[model samples]
Target: MNQQWRLDDGQQTLVLAARSGRLPECVYWGAPLPVTEDLVALHAAYALDVTGGMLDENPDLSLCPQSARSFPGQPGLVLRCTDEIRMLYGLCFVDAQQNGPDLRLSYRDAAAGIDLTFSFTTDPQTHVITCQTTLNTDRPVQVDWLAAPVLPAPQLSDEMIDVSGRWCGEFQLIRTPWSAGLRMREARTGRSGHEHFPGLIVPNRGTTNCQGEAYAFHYGWSGGHRMLAEELPDGRRQVQFGHATNTQAAGTQFQTAPLYITYSNTGLNGCAVAFQRHVRDRIVTDAHPVRPVHYNCWEAVYFDHKLPELQDIATRAAALGAERFVLDDGWFGLRDDDTSSLGDWTVDARKYPHGLTPLIDHIHSLGMSFGLWFEPEMVNESSALYRAHPDWVLGPMDQIRGRQQLVLNMASADVRDYLYDRIAAILSAYDIGYIKWDHNRLLPAPDAAQTHGTYALLDRLRADFPQVEIETCASGGGRIDFGILKHTQRVWLSDSNDALERLRIQHDAALFLPASVTGSHVGPRHCHTSGRTIDISMRAWVAAQRHMGFEMDPRELTDHEAKVLTDVTAWWKANRDWMMRADILRLDSADPAVIAEQQLAQCGSRFVVFAGKAATSAQIQPRPMRLTGLDPAATYCINVINRDHTPGLSRGNPALKSGPLTLSGAYLMHHGVTLPWHFPETMWVLEGTRK
Candidate 1:
């Protein structure tokens, strides 16, 4: 018997049906239907095969399981029986149940004593569908491969978009035409490394920022994961995402990570808005308080942890309108550099003769919160902690070290308890408001159990100390995913704070993550990674768009630069709500050297537009940049926020030295306004208030 089920979230509907005592298959996954209809009749009317036929008999057919059935690419599930291998495609359908917006379908192989269940959930507000699969067996079954949320792409999806980059330069967007063969992106570093993000976007031909159909998928796992986009022989497409499960013993039940999928007809921006809302409301339920303007001591002083020098820096930071002061690295056990003393979480008596009390009190007296950095998952061979517990490390006795450190065996209960107790002790002893939780090294020979251990540790910490905020940093953006975001408040996006490079990185990351959760800091003139010296205004402008912070020493700024910082910080503080809650829009531009973005207020009362020029052009005439996401009927007063405008530099469009310029929102968005084009590597910030 064929049983059909449908889940509707008003705006979208997902239809799935079981065929003749077998596993269920997806029928339709886009748009809304006014009435529930038979999926088989719909498929037949659309000239689609209900079973996708047999792979061998019809070479062009695309099967969902693609197991020993001879379909191309990877199989969805691989099961090792007593003497032979078996796949789930041939299993008999048992039953299905739907409760509210959740659905579960079960399949069973009586002879093999294997039971497989696929669970589906939908977010009513965002219209996002999340799916996961679980396998259970009476006998021992070694499961090799499995993927969740195996989605089918629409016929019109002809292009694919994803991101890839190296350390300090993450989230570089890449778009390519859909073709035959398998496109796979895997992260095996035991963390969501910077090389590839576990998100995929498929769009129709000629998709733009604001128009065309688009579909997006994001895996919520923080550990090793893989995303595959395969184009089958018959113009059919499949998108699969799941954790990298190497092998599992028999009698052990395996559950894959949840995969989220959303669709939009209004292009990538529409997909982004849906994802941002879903993440904020479902994944991260805690209210994200206004992100403070923080001052970090890493770029300023490196490993030099002198109390008096830090006190001086905190004073200057408070004077420059910093709300929090973070002391990064070198504050613990003989840790002058990264070479020694990582797991030893005790304060260095030589650096602070008394204790952290004096420094913490000083920062509090200055009306600023205090934050500390720690890498609890790593340890150095020379450290006292490692000498006492050598078996605590994950790898072999003679394992190769990275960053002069070895990975701690988080899978062990003893190791988890010790680290948790140490961190809990610090939280209990001091008035610490924040923790910069960092992971500097990758886990060697990672297992699924280790990831569960890490999650349990974080869950215990958050439950014990809910007041203290934790920022996840894995050598700059190596562990950015919805799984980690559920526990941490924010993430360190990258180590490179070069303003020009950060513009691209932040833009691409904002596609799936909100700006409030992305940590952007203004670094020194010479960036540590890129070594590019950008103007202070440009640096402050780029960082202000996200969770704003500063990583450089205030003592290094000139008088003019100090004023600029003060003004920028004040402006950001006043407008923090808009940056935190506004809908993001990436504006289209004809010039390659220009990058523009707009943040439209949810209330429809205000908006902010950022236009930056990377290099100067030889053309004297400036082009009028068209703005987006504004009410056409409303009138608005557009004012330049940054006061660093150069007048009379360009020949055609002269700078306006006047008060607020008034114009209708329709005119400003359609006809647009021209900006100064003479100076290279500069940015302009414009604020619009509906009048």
Candidate 2:
């Protein structure tokens, strides 16, 4: 069997140190130890479920981490670790049997070992799986796991990854891991700490362009979490999973593994690797459940709506029990809607009399949180800021177009300080809790030519404000990624508001992002983009299950629809905890139809099932629907709440029973029950023992 995957000559020739079952036995080094490696000296670790042949649970893994150590004048430098470490990597294909193939890797000190034992399918197709390590270990460990096999190429530029082409690069580090911090730092002039954590350190040819060849995702589980370092096709070297995006060099999706060691006494270090092999027009995160439902005024006001009108909407929304009231675009600058009022930070006097103070005060009075929208990175020809600082705009200084809108030079220190000041000033004026920071356009110059320092400005805001929650939005879903999620609390998933369109889009989004970080809203039936009227109940129910909000004019909702909205909001308030901490199980369907089910396990026993938009069926039998992360022996009371009408069933059936029924078969073959019916429904409260 060929274990080598996409290996080049350099990697093929790379020698792995030999390991014998019995090590050089010494007083300090032997087969076993009375004293385990200190957890403080570890970087990451993984537990393998050898009994179940899956990573079903890992409670015994360990790591040893210490302060970063760096030696000067070294290329491809490898750090010598005094502490021992262990990492476990496992994979169980959804289609494979419960006793199928599970791959586990244990890395200790500097040696790495792999344990591949499982039932390989008859078909020969390799599936790549990865986990990113969290970098915040108690002690520091320096390493880059996602080492993309370097191709014979020129230096990597923002352009090669700017569009659709293959990419290859390497990450090298020569330092004491504990001496450095979490983020990977890069240098344009010096070579020191260039390939540190979260930064792509590739073999350079002393030029700015690459040879158009690169490997994608390689990572390790570190800091009690998984981390991946890969140079994506979109000109962004994403570290971990936080800011995962393929947009036009606007920003990056940054992420690493979870932090917090599983057990207090294991000494091991591990990292994760991930790859999005398929090519898609855009890259988005998964649909997180229980995203705060929001109320924004963009389509309704468009810079013309009066403060009273805005106040009325916010008050009514609060009365209906909305979590947040977002004052959309036009609230800042002379601009309104996509054109006129950008870059200008002043609140329009005619529209907002007495500034935003009255509006914010009114929102606060209603016992709700207030969110204001701002697009500080864009400029209109008529705006005061653009006139005052023409050089601040990104386009050719002399270039002029009929519709003159300019991009702010976010790379410049002056621009960042100025924008930060404007944002801080307004936020201070009102006791604001959230900001819906919007960027309506892509980078006018794909290469990020602007002089306004993007990462620095953003990092400054996070460090400075600390309290404000920023929701990153770029024209809709263009800018969703991990890098932004680190500092911002929420992100608008996409501009495509159609519920039918959202099902697939959200499914794709959730693969990389947790449900808590995404913004999935329940908009009006008549979408602003598609001009189609969908059932409000269906939309609300689906959106409500995820981090949600409303986008339409509330006044337009019928009395009956309004009640549904109010009722659903109440339910969300009551049941938020279950949606937040529980592990999610999503069922798959292959019929080019819409059938989605999310099972949330609470307290590790009780579970909630949200089955949305399925085709009508007398009996809905999901294949191998084994519940995840449950205690096999503890019995649970299973309840099914049917939100839609299926022929033979009613809402909240107390007699439904299943698992504690052992999880046998492939993940797909795991224990799943048959529902009597389906379609635009939500069947929940299914519980059982993990037998």
Candidate 3:
């Protein structure tokens, strides 16, 4: 029997080895190893030496660490029989198969009647390696934990960056230096909580946005998840990701969500590019190749959905170049506010006496496609559906509610069928092309079944209405992940339309998400969530940076604001073709006050830079912002596209502010761009065309 195997894409390689039929362990994972290298010798060298206070020999630390084997740190599996006999081990490898760039290995615990399988596949294009594990038993078992195949972290790393955020502020990066103990993060809010996003990045000691080495991992699960970054007392490190402990109920079989990992040779942006490409080009299917400009009326109308008012909003949104108008949250039942009539999916007669047809038709007549919002997985106790089937609510009968609503029992076949029927009926009756599928509240508890059932429903919907697009929004940005994104086309980045706050959130989120699926909107003049007003030009340009949209009431815009918005919308439309396909690269800024990014076209012919002055710089002069991912030998023409936004502060002329300058890409990337000084909350937009 073969004792060693390995899989390699062009950029990276993963080598696994096993002895005496024990479960295989990954001995090497990083930049590509030579094809002719000796796997056996490499595996031997990778083994750690047992020292004083440790066992006579080192434990394998196999893909599934075993408790019975006396492995230190967190064991990969936690199980029980009936109510006792918690320990189960002695698994033997039973099968192995290597095909192309994919590998599958199987193992079994005979006495326990348990079969475990680990699978891996590397995408040659995006260079992302996806891994998953499955556990099946002949009889019922209570499994508290089952991690995806564990991988070792580099010892040279000094710190780790994990994602953390809240309601209005999502995708904030927190960095913690490496230590000798374990670092654990668990999202137990049922939905992937706004507080803990399932991602981590470990950079080499001297890594930056454009240099050195980096490794990234994203647990692509929408339900609760737990991440373990542990450095054992022996100095060995490993990363484990799985559903939050005990999220699974007793079952005969269980499997984990796919764990996506990518190693970057060119610093953090390389990881960013890999994830961004894999998500947009590989995961999302049939996304209208040309992403339409969005106009959601949630902030504009809330629950006051009057026919004339909606018609007016639609006309205004269209005039400002919105191609898809999504009538948000208040068009159904008695949903006058967030609290009531959530489960009722019917069009409200009070708001639209003749039904949604009038408003939808008005939107369609204005040359924009119409979209409706639905919270299919939530129910108000005051709703007719909830009253009729109280048993359909998840958790205990006395469980607390969120946003005045209880979660629907998505695990129940009856619940899924009812939701599909209601949602499908609406699709058949209307010429709708999009659905803003909302999940405004967290579940009473974490249950993997709920996420699976939701996926099942989405799959059914996608098959039935292949052309209809769906946006997964959970209280703004709570449910954004690769798992949910597999079913939906777009993600509502955050509820806060405050440009200053958005500039930071969007910049950090660009580490994983691409510009095409991230929805950024221009909020009202007085930002509802943040309460700090931002300039119309600032709001418009920020929205234009991603999947452009407008969620504000167009009627409230002053003549100057309206013109500025219209011009920015036109600019977004002109660039959407290539911009949607661009790779968003976070630039290394010399000044911390300026948060910046460069969206480079896929063809490498052009790029645009958004340098947002988030706060007042302590230094009076702006610092040079270095760009990445450009050919050093190429020459390019650079122009400050938003030069008109320059506020007169008696500023001396900065070369970029005066006119376009033709410079070599090497000079642009190394010497960097110098923009005129700007007040806080302002942004400088630069366009570059390779000559």
**lDDT top scorer:** 3
- Candidate 1 or 2, higher lDDT? 1
Steric clashes per prediction: 1, 104, 0
Model 1 segments beyond 4 Å from truth? 36-40, 46-70, 81-89, 245-251, 285-288, 617-620, 651-671
Off by over 4 Å in 2: 1-292, 397-404, 448-452, 590-592, 614-632, 643-671, 680-691
Model 1 C-alpha lDDT per residue in residues 312-348, reported as the tens digit of each score = 9999999988999999999889998889998888888
TM-score of each: 0.94, 0.58, 0.98
Candidates 1 and 3 compared by lDDT, better number:
3
Give the per-residue lDDT digits (tens) of candidate 3, residues 512-580: 999999999999999999889898888998998899999999999898998999999999999999999
lDDT of 3 at 177: 86
lDDT of residue 323 for candidate 1: 94
lDDT of each structure?
A: 0.80, 0.43, 0.90
Which lDDT value does model 2 have at 11?
Answer: 13
Full candidate order by TM-score, most accurate first: 3, 1, 2
